[model samples]
Target: MIEARQLTKRYGDKTAVDGVDFTVRPGAVTGFLGPNGAGKSTTMRMIIGLDAPTAGTVTVNGRRYAEHSAPLHEVGALLEARSIHPGRSAFDHLMVLAHTHGIGRARVTEVIEMTGLQAVARKRAGAFSLGMGQRLGIAAALLGDPQTIMLDEPVNGLDPEGVLWIRTLLTGLAAEGRTVFVSSHLMSEMALVADHLIVVGRGRVLADTTVQELVLQAGGDTVDVTTDDPAGLRRVLTGPGVEISGRPGSEQLSVTGLPARAIGLAAARHGIALFELTARTVSLEEAFMELTKDSVEYHAANTLVGAA
Candidate 1:
């Protein structure tokens, strides 16, 4: 497990990570989410001892990363794939990391096969495609056979097949009772992989909850109803705590705060001609946009002008 207690960091006049507390439990994939410049990268760097925190503390397996006797075996991370030397071959890079910890060639070969890097093991990393570089980076992270894994933007440059492979790999790792913490801005991808989420903005923690809980907290359910007389349907739904709006390109009414069955029953009671009635649950992307809309630091020119 990984824990942070009142963790904080600052650079001169700007604070990168505010005082925050959270726990990353084992046997599940926890997603870290936030907008750009929201302190996620800074927090991960502090957890791995790459940056010193100005206040508070973080620990992995009950000890600071610097205090671990075998740090690589305890926590394996892929903060940024491009951190490796560009001129080195994939095999040589992993070998150098192994030499530092006295790990053997067998373990290196195992990770190469695990990440599907056998075909390009001898290619210079600088010449490899972005997707191949991501694979090599993952291989390095798994080289130590660590119990805790943390990756920042692991799927930034992956193809569809590579993306599917990562999803399966992360699920398998968590099933083995290991701690998996990954950060990404892709809400759809995170929804498919993560069991829980940690949302942050403006150097502060906004939320720490399960995926289901986050969705519930965002808002009520959405129900889409299609009828021959949308106007009549809207009139019937015009009541307290219920909202009706027109759906694009169809004779459908978007209803909120009402169940699909209730809408259907209302139409049936009125003898209205109905074509369809279905519940439209909001996507994870929509929920995330609502959660972090106000916390975003930088906005596009049009948005900024509108806000002003």
Candidate 2:
């Protein structure tokens, strides 16, 4: 497990991370989410002792990262930036990292195969594509078979099959009771894999909750209804806290603040035959955008001519 208490970092006069407190527990994949410059990278670096925090504390198991004798066995990390020597072969790179931890060739070969790097294992790291580089980095992180795994954008530039491989790998690792903390931009994939989330913005923690809770907190439940009598059904279902919208002269009406069952019943009471009625839950992507809209540090200018 990883724990942070009031963790903070500052550079000159610019505070990169505020007093942030969170814990990443074992047996589940906890996604670390944030906008750009939200101090996610700084927090991860402090957890692994790459950068010293100006205040507060971070611990990897029960002690600071530097206090561990066998750090490789305690935690494995894949950062956003590639860290391997470009001139070295992928196989050679893993071999060297393994040697640092007293690990052997057998384990190196195992991770090589596990990350699907066999074909390019002998190729120079400089020649690998972005996807291949990501695979190699993951292979190195798994080299020690550590108890905790932290990754940033582990599936960047990966093909569909590679993305699936990463999803399965993360799930399998968490199933083995290891702590998996990852930061990613892929909300769809994170929604599918992560059991919990830690959302941050403006150097402060915005939310630390389950994926389901975040979606529900967005406060909108929608039901789509297509019927022969849109006007009649609209009138029948309209009430306090209920909203209905549709394209003018269209048969489909989108309803809010009403359950699908209620809509169906209302249609029946109005003697209106409903063609289609379905509930649509707010997706994780939509919830994230809504929650973080105010904290976005960089805003793009919309200068399109006559855009509505």
Q: Pick the candidate with the highest lDDT.
A: 2
Residue-level lDDT for 11 in candidate 2: 96
Error of 2 at 171 (Å): 0.7
| Model 2, residue 175: C-alpha shift (Å) | 0.7
Which 10-residue window in model 1 sums to the lowest lDDT? 299-308
Task: Give the root-mean-square deviation of each candidate in angstroms.
Answer: 4.4, 3.7
Clashing residue pairs, backbone N/CA/C < 3 A, model 1: none
Residue 281 miss distance in model 1 (angstroms): 1.8
Clashing residue pairs for model 2: none
lDDT of 2 by residue, 181-273 (tens): 999989999999999899999888999999988987874688999998899988999899888999989999999889999999878877999
Misplaced by over 4 Å in model 2 are: 224-258, 270-278, 304-308
lDDT of 2 at 64: 96
Runs off by more than 4 Å, candidate 1: 225-258, 270-278, 303-308
For 129-229, candidate 1 gives per-residue lDDT tens digits of: 88898999899889899999999999978999999999999999999999999999888889899999999998899999988878866655888888888
